[model samples]
Target: MSPSWEDESAAVIAQGLRRRGFLTAAGLAATAALVAGRPERAHAAVSGSRAMPYPFTLGIASGDPLSTAVVLWTRLAPSPFEVDGGMATDSFPVQWVVAEDASMATVVRRGTALAHAEYAHSVHVDVGGLRPDREYWYQFRCGPHLSGVGRTRTAPAPGAHLDHLDLVVASCQSLGAGWYHAWKDAASEPADLVYFAGDYIYEYATDATSVRWPYTPSLPADFTRQTDTLGRFRQQYGLYKSDPDLQEAHRVSPWMVTWDDHEVFNDYDAEDPSLYQLRANAYRAFWEHMPLRSPQRPSGYTARMYRQLDYGDLARFHVIDARQYKTGQLPGSTVGDTAERRDPSRQILGTAQEAWLLDSLGSGATTWDVMANTVLFSRLDSDDTAGERFSTGQWDAYQAAQQRVIDTVAAKDAGGFVVLTGDIHRNYHLNVLKDFEDPDSAVVGVEFAGTSISSGRDGGETDSGLEVRTRANPHLVSADLRRGYLRCRISHDVWTTQVRAIDRISTLDYRAWTSHTLVTEPRRPGLQVS
Candidate 1:
């Protein structure tokens, strides 16, 4: 029989009663089962009789989808900002349910996964044996408390023909900078997927000017300190996940996440052995919070995050990890086009990942090959007429590697290659050229670098430097310094991108609108403003 929402509600009510000392743990479990009107297997699996803390405060998320399966995630954190999330140093069985409808009346799968204390009592259930190209609602139950239901959709079969893919690309959401109105708006849409480009959570404490959580329960006495260790990183994730808007967005759609520098340390790379241990801790905490399977988890300091996910024959997304393997920025200004900056051997994506990306791009049979890349892949020449330079942190620092990737796309005749980027906290629409320094170079693809969710606070509409920046680089289209995300509608014939910007991020006012619309035809590689 299918699960019932009425029963879930009853379970919640029973949980409240248990918490209020009106019922024993076993009595509460039995009462919830009775209220749910479900069999023993349908209700949550009860273990200890001790009163348990509310564990779903961090909310639930689902992601890393496949045709047959997707990962459903939740961390047991009754006291989120506490050192250990208020979870005992033990394991608990978390019962998960997948249904076809939001009411959860039509159940498809139900299973129990052990929430491991070693990994912050988080549960990542790799539920499989499901139909493809459809939506599913899922929820978890522990003791008498039930989590909010999350909606997730699996990708179509590898060779299956499809019409389009609706997606939102977002990045750089610093919790303390502003509100999450952007995420709230995005969650209201019916997008098939969400691409978290990077900076899922900032590592540092809030500054004097930044707004912070008004009610940070369980926060450490010194919660303002920067995150560096495993415990601290886990607390950071917990703090960010506590945001309702972000949790709702994750609850609504499956996300493909790839982290940038802030997820570890700012602008860090694999070149330093000293940072490896810190990276390991950060990576572990990230995996613990995210709805990722075992394959993406860290084995020591190394985690294989760069991988490909094909959305049927319509599109194939190659999610890249730029921060983990790139070399340190060369000694130059943020936008200095030095000879060292253009060094051919300067590494980004390391060696193996580059090869893997090339292979994935070359082998893709889809109409569009999208790179869910963090950091800009295209060049951004400074508007300064005195001297032209580029951001050393981006692909511009290693122009040789950038060109190789673009050349591979061109050489393979890859159709409609698009790069979706985040970081830099701005909106940019640019033509990915064969040689960014040469105006006459062929346009291999187009790039849409989205603005942050709430990173830079409230920015004005007009930037005086926009004109000079675009004039210096002919391929540059539109640039907005505000905070928001990119909404892309992809099809076999055309790709449409909308720059969805938030008018203000400091307040609860959710005044957001599409600032610019751009479109690119299948065979035509350049972008045209709509």
Candidate 2:
């Protein structure tokens, strides 16, 4: 009973979170009144309703952006696989709206926020004054049911710069391995954010070569594909948010997620104390279905997912959190390029997130410095004749913590250091070497690994181990295996990346293409073939 965020102090929680301005709206209504008044601990259970039901299934979302503010979300789960989702320990009130025209006809803000069944009836809502590189449009109501109209944006007025930044770097999907049409063509592009980078949900289930339709419904024989407790990880994120192409790409854009190794377990680490209450129920169901804010919610197994999001002077996103203070992987080598897996006190982004990512890549006030990485940070040498067998679950098992981020991007000559990766499921285009066993090393930046939306089930558009893994790794430069996503287009010189493939994820008629585009310049550090 001593943990309601156990007596603060991390310097009074970073000086009361630097005077609460993050995710604004009064710091998410003071974290929804500290998780709806705790209810004598064990959070997730609240009551005081006035009758309600059609609780906007798991739809709408928006996240962590801030030039002004943004953090809307939803989850009253009207029977989202029962247990507690079919809500009852009540407390609805919900009502949110934040238009700037999408036929929402101009109103700017609206609020009400408190759909707590402790937290399962989720509802973040950090919205603020807005208008900082704007493009709003939001929705949610809870008693006249109206939840689907999302599209968010805001984050480019900080240092104010010039021109593009259309992101969309996805990750592993795995809902029985197919169908989401690359998240419905990245939610009909016109993108302006969506980094993702993790497996999103896949604590193992649907085997026997399943292949679709909510994994062919008919569960509850104590259904288990290894999701230990917390009501089977909130019924596996209410069956992957009951996919409507991943809830229409979280209802059209505005995401910046993080989390890998199937959200928990697949590679579990957090200095395991017998899986610390299964990483506090997988970080409280990944902060009750992410649209994160309130300093990345989850306080039980400590969840302060690495932060940083600036687009003003044109990019500065350090969003790293490589498996919550990583340390395991190095035993029977499931991908650990040995040599004691390059141990420099073995750790990945851990020591205070590698000193807040080398003080935000040596604070070179943005001109591109992206790094929303999850796994794979360059070198994938299987037999490049040297770095001996790589992989140990990425950054080739922390080679001196990936060479202290390539010697701090070569001693802060930073020069636009891009690195948006995702766990290995396909697509590549490497060239991030400041060492990788030096094959004339010193290319120091560029990595674009994305390729998985619908894990690896229907792949193939060139693969037979891609010409011996790009001829024993010559900094790879193109290697696709199918199912897609990865479309960046930053400007102020160049950063074009467009792999975007999708010949099939097993029907739903979503045939996309563009199988290879690359390009890098901005102080040039490799990769090009536009």
Candidate 3:
């Protein structure tokens, strides 16, 4: 996967990922994949161009959840999700405001929105009344440009019992796989909200294992589209919305995203062909460059991505969709094959997002129940490691709907549960036991599972029998495959967590302490990492 990553482009792979990050996201994602993957690049970027430019040049974001209000995204760059930064800014009808005072002089909400370069001109409002857990500041405009002021907060009152929360949980990044400096050390820690939980960018069909920093962009980079075009899915979502450390970690924080399968590729399966027409152009370029949720808008290739978010009583996230409703990869799973990796009716969140996570955990209000889904929900018996052996991508290939969601949250009494997760690169901490056929019936929940902030496994050279398969998975408590991420400090009776990591992902003066912490308590049971 090297020969100059065959057909590379997207401004020379985001200027070599702005200059090295973490083994450049799987060595430049095997060279930004897809030389028409042996004949797939035809749809000719679905025509209809010309339009872009206004108060959107890749900036603004915020996604804190439940304490209510916080989901402000912006796009309209038309040239940064992958390509085509040419024309059309829908005659500039963009204006968005929110503030606890970032100098808008006491403004709390302002209007006028429209960055429609056919979605490439992104804009995800979801503002909502505000005042739940304070600390806000925002920006966005068009007529004379404005964006570049973001900081978000709200979510400290579903049961109110706060003392601390500072969160963070990232996942596979890839825009050339490097220099997000683990999101610049999670925007210098002291977090408030960051749960990315998915491979943000990676649609390129073939870049031949991009040998150490080399996918010279000019075509589409990684938006994936040899055919089924819509201007090559807005030029691969304007090359990952022109990365500026994923736009300064989405301008600092207010994110709770959940898309896993490289946003729209890896392990995909809406109906089949494992990425049916590249999942209709990566779901219309992932709701046209993030900040989504007007019901997952994206007209060209259809996108409805499931939803859920809450964090006031301290957590109730339960977010899922595991790549647009599943039901694939399990039919004779490959790689290292452990009898096709323990396939018990293989699935990953299907059956209506698993009955909306059992009616959102039987309609609970909040006091901790987070699951912000995307691969790795614990119980990894990863045999020879690869595919299967538990992991048809995640929730252990939906084993009878993940044991009916761990036997109905260990037959209910539920309260401070935790799942978190992100694809398997490394870093775990489990205790979520609950009758994997009773080796001891209840332990209930808790499962951090992060790692891979500049993405890819460098964990000092893999196989340590995978750190003894995380103590042979009896509700693992530690697995440090290494890389970094997963902060959680919450409190109100131990939320603790740590697993930060960073002797180096790139650097922003990082020291990122607490390589392990765990804790968990509230609806009480197993989990204690320290």
Identify the candidate with maximal TM-score.
Answer: 1
TM-score against native, each model: 0.91, 0.35, 0.34
Per-residue CA lDDT of model 3 for 384-497, tens digit only, reads 343335545666656566777877776666776777877776777777777554446677787777877765533532466676576456667677666767777776577887
Model 2's TM-score against the true structure: 0.35
**Which tens-of-lDDT digit does each residue in 1-530 have in candidate 1?**
43354476445434432111112343334224222321121223233443775577677889989999999999887767676888799999998999998767788999999998899999999999989999998888887667766789999998898888899999999888888888878988958999999999998974454564442232465557888889999888877886667877898899999889899888875789998889999999999998888999998888999988988888899999998777788765475666777688888899999989998994868899899999888888875586876877889888889988988999998888999999979888899887776888988899999889987668766676766787787888888788889888998999999899898877665588888899997688999998
User: What is the descending TM-score order?
Assistant: 1, 2, 3
* lDDT values, one for every candidate: 0.81, 0.74, 0.61
Clashes of each: 4, 3, 61
> What is the TM-score (0 to 1) of candidate 3?
0.34
Poorest stretch of ten by lDDT in candidate 1 = 34-43
Model 2 residue 99 lDDT score? 78
When sorted by lDDT, best at the front, the candidate numbers are 1, 2, 3
Q: What is the C-alpha RMSD of each candidate to the true structure, in Å?
A: 6.1, 19.5, 20.6
Error of 3 at 456 (Å): 29
Clashes of 2: 3
Our tally of clashes for model 3 stands at: 61
